[model samples]
Target: MSESTLTSGAPITQLPDDYMQNPHEVHHMLRAEGPVREVRTPQGLKVWFVTRYDEVKTALTAPGISKKLMGRVRHDALTEHMVFMDPPHHTRLRKLVTKPFTARRVEALRPRVEEIAAELIAKLDDGDVVDLLDVFAVPLPVAVISELLGIPIDNRDEFRAWSNQLINVSTPDEVQAATSGMADLLYRHVREVQAAEPDDTFFSALVHATESGDRLTTEELVSMAFLLLVAGHETTVNLIGNAVFQLLRNPDQLQVLKDRPELIPASTDEFLRLEGSINIASFRYTTEPLELGGVTVPAGELLMVSLLAANRDPERYEDPDRLDVTRPVQGHLAFGHGIHFCLGAPLARLEFDVALTQLLARFPNLELAAEPETLVWRDSTLVRGLHTLPVRLA
Candidate 1:
């Protein structure tokens, strides 16, 4: 798993220990060698890793590739949601929740989102050294999603713990525990929503959502809730954390943002391109022999698209590694592409805009409390984010 192994052109057996901390070096090598490479994930699952931008896009939308997990039973309630399904089923589940996250509906939430950011920032004193993820990044989106879904935020810490375990846990026992805890908590909430009168909240709507006389079953309701709960906040948490971390590392970029705060919204995509929350899109399997990037992947092999890698492909961007907040980053695959594009992209963008604006306005002298190299990233290929972000709020 050393860097030299990547240079040898032999298939990568396992990812380096620091892959989560920084994957671009490996991405660069793989992109240069070929468009696709066979690699065993840190989890020991072999997959056809799609690296180059064009091929990644093709793999994302290819008819021969399937989103459904092959030869495995549904592991938990979370597995039943849209991210793991193909069309018709994915279409149905996604349609039921799409209206609530539309651009107009999300824009209407701007004021509330601002208020949430302000309230959270208000609690931190200028001189205090705090783990920004816990104090700011993690809670803001959790609150927004909780309120939107009409779920109680009183147990947010527990929610955060459940999310962390489910995303990063390496062992089956841990995964089972996290899955059970999330399923139990969400099932109770879904039942409560079902008992109450239909309301405007997203969860309530899902509980009562209908399309052409078809309604979500109880299991489907709970599973959908689980997906929204996790997907809603997870991306924003890392987006905010990673953006701040990058700005701190690049002081000039930080100053530029502080001086011209109007650029905050536009910079969201740039941040996403540099350090998106999800490293790899969810799992896919080939339904038939497929040609991607001149490589023929056999039928039924596991497939994964490296979004972080594709965003930095030299063939695509003029300067892929540099952090320039003003750069035009329109077509980035951070929120993914095609029909499986993130349902919460609008909300995630709105949150990033508000969070960064309020944060820089309040503390212009923010800096990392720990050495840059000392910060630990979460140990999950599915998520690319720090375990904590310690910052001096000056």
Candidate 2:
């Protein structure tokens, strides 16, 4: 830890532009100082940022640290979702959707995911510079999740438009409008499905779901659908994009995976650890005053673990900054930890493993078409992905 950095808090806004392209450097600076520090989000909310790996694992499951910040959060649609709820509520909601999101169910989509990737890659036959994020990474997950959830194929663009607004904090109108629109759509769908008999589709599954005896209410159902549909694809889209970006930069590692295509699974985890999609875990507040990472964080104050930072913590993984595709990544927090661990992890991993392998195989000489310095990154404190990845597949 440096003496000067200890005195001056690291401002999230003033982080170097390189931090946007690759945030691990900024994360390294914060982790070097200590495990946890205070900072203001782009939204101007003062919050404690948890940076170390061990501390993050502990904080994620801390009883005093909770996700139930009822009135504190502005977005009500997201409020009733499992990610935002504490225990009983979250547990109940999760159980209903767990059946469809199980490992077996996700694996069943293997052929479908592979087919989707192959179909998308087949379109890139024009040997020209194309934005992979647009033609590949972005569409693949949206299509897969929408299919799994029985969301109409026609709704993908609206979902993306609304979801983009929902995830980014810059556009309050967009976020609000998106949330409101999703609420109506999900609620209406739930009711429509419930009015008739249910099917095996995710929409029908939730509409008729019963856990031990209790069922998700209209509000809870609406919120769950919104969260699942948005989160289902958003992170994976970034996962696919981030993996390609890292591998393109580290050609040796890329070739290692290319030669042994079996290594794409491990490489997915490496990318999650090295350049994870989420900027930070969603909001958690201290349920009661408690000591964390040597700091006495008072109750009701906002707290979050930098998922990307913890994954890169030197204390947890050796050469954490380097991208090693063959490295073991069994317990990485990219899918998070504790009761709130991502339910869609199975699906996300399946998507990444399938998409990356197919894309690499399809474009044997794939490389960044643009200079690295000229790349544009999406501006969101919560997501880490290139806005567009221009690549040459020839």
Candidate 3:
């Protein structure tokens, strides 16, 4: 469909303000306009924003299209993992990486994860205001990923800082600079670990895979490690931060969790649905002409799926705007759909469940230190989350 077909009030390239505050209005507009509409990023990349649930499903799992197109389209820095690959290659790489992220594997770190959270909470002054993001959200995921990858505790801070800089959507130059620094760090760290001949860690496991008949290239290993380290924690940090922010905004829901801890698991799902951290889908390219939402996407066009919009699609969920703590939002696209679904989803859920449960139990009197509108959010079209969530521990 032509750009003019949609409302002239809605710009073709830039994301509208309604998308930031209440995206349902824009989703309704796009859905009414049709499923696949011509949109462009601020960078001026022409893309088809998939709005409807059924159309998003089709685009994500559609044949002919491959995740590998990411490298083809923009091969500047993000040159790693099955996240940018498709089918056989994606399948193989995902299998190699998935071995260590299994429920048993991730759950094995529960005690350590809880210890980290407890330590963080202990540092907060009782009845004193604190930024949940600084005190909890950011560190929890960094610690978990660092421990899993055998990164030295001393280096954890550096890693987290670099990851944030690398994924900074507000500025492309910062992302590029972070990419270069991360690449340099990756090589140095890989060499250091190789020389040390460390015990069984995720990095060591990857080294073993490379040495074995599996034969992963050195470049591939480096890229894979970077991908895992960055992608591993970024989304989860936002998820935890977003959950705490939402709960603080709605004290009734916080009390609900405080009263019945059993709801932690279900509430985690609902939080992801309502304010799911990962807001935007990765760029998907069309392999051939395909009909969707009454528009045909010719071969080789880029498709940008709005995961945030799809999660709030009225057709999929009743009263999509309301945040019902008890709602069963199991099928939400927060972690995405199909083969490219998040591999670390289970671990993220576990972290949120444990962190929030323990957090509320520790500080039942928690409240926002500042108004919700005052809280600053990370301004990136890719991932959506708050930069800081000020709160009072009282």
Candidate 4:
């Protein structure tokens, strides 16, 4: 194994309070200092950081990097989804759910997504100053995913509570509790699903999905539901929330988008480029020793890419730090790359586009209700998002 140039215990991506509020500083540091660097995590384990766009893109699809578990990590963490698998198994698991998440299926939900976004706006009308994350950004995506999966609408509150802890938990105890609780709840829901006759719901389709005589086992089915319910909405929750946060913070951009409402879809791409919900891809174990960004990454070592840093690399984007909704924003690694590219990108884009458009149309005078300094962010290593976005509508 090659030794790292970084000093022992030096931090990689995890940073101070200010950096949490504005991570572009860290991204700048990553870009200016070392595109391929190493540092100790809060957990004290050292890992390689790929901070440049070209290097990150190459590493994402590298043959020597496999997404399958290669260490002491628990399987319960993946929730039995394809996001954690290498191909053949990953391909099989992803195939069962691919048709349901195709562009057509997501497009079919756009009208309903509009309905949900509008309803959420109407509900927020009672309060002049409100937390948009609570009333709009969070619920709109959850509602869409829940409805898509045919989950009963009444269970949303409970589902959201469990889902939040799983995605943003800040402690080890919270992780154990959230993991065990979600596993139990989803398993029970799966049993309930299997005990009944099938229907046209996505959950039912997953339960019955077969290919060349292959079918999802009960464990796999539950894991699939758990993955969809969490990943399906979590990333989009941040996607929409982060987008609205960006537009509101950048008034010039906000007014531009408001005047040209059709730009909302394109704006989502810019927002993803800026503050993508997923900061790092799932862990990839090296299949063979590889050279990455001038450093030798030994075989079997765990590696992670900083999508946050990569998307902001000045070498990859002109004026990369500026938030331009109209920038030609393709090729950003917001939804990731390679065989594991996000299955829900179409759904997420549609939801954000609808939500931002309806929000701007309904409250043309919307403004921030809280000081940007006081806003809190979820303390997550793999995702970047605000905990709440308070706004005023007039």
What are the lDDT scores of the predictions, listed in order?
0.86, 0.79, 0.76, 0.78
**Each candidate: RMSD to true structure?**
2.5, 3.0, 3.2, 3.1
Q: Pick the TM-score winner.
A: 1
Model 1 TM-score relative to the real fold: 0.95
Better of 2 and 4 by lDDT: 2
Model 4 Cα lDDT, one tens digit per residue, 1-394: 1233445444345444444556667667767767676654545566777789988998888889887662246666335678778778888988888855667666888888888887788776734888888888878888888778766547676676667676663576876777787777667777787888988776777787788888888888778877888888888889978887777789999999889998888778889998899887777778898787787788988787888888988888898878999998879998899898988888888888888888888888888888787888876667788888999886
Worst 10 residues of 4 by lDDT: 1-10
Give one digit per residue, the lDDT tens place, for model 3 in 1-394: 2243335474463446435555556667887778877775545566788988788888878896767775764574348677888878877777777765567877877898899899998898787877788778888888888677766547666666677775555366766777777788777766776677646666677665532356455676678777777777887888888888887777788788888988998888888887788766877788889888778888987888888778878888898877779887768888889999988888888888889888888888888889887776775556778878888887
Measured by lDDT, the strongest candidate is: 1
Give candidate 1's total backbone clashes: 0
Model 1 stretches with alpha carbons more than 4 Å out: 2-13, 70-73
How far off is residue 57 in model 2, in Å?
Answer: 1.0
On a 0 to 100 scale, what is the lDDT of residue 325 in model 3? 92
Candidates 1 and 4 compared by lDDT, better number: 1
Name the lDDT of candidate 2.
0.79
Worst 10 residues of 3 by lDDT: 1-10
Question: Roughly what TM-score does model 2 have, to 2 decimal places?
Answer: 0.92
TM-score of every model versus the real structure? 0.95, 0.92, 0.90, 0.92
Pairs with backbone N, CA or C atoms under 3 Å apart (clashes), candidate 1: none
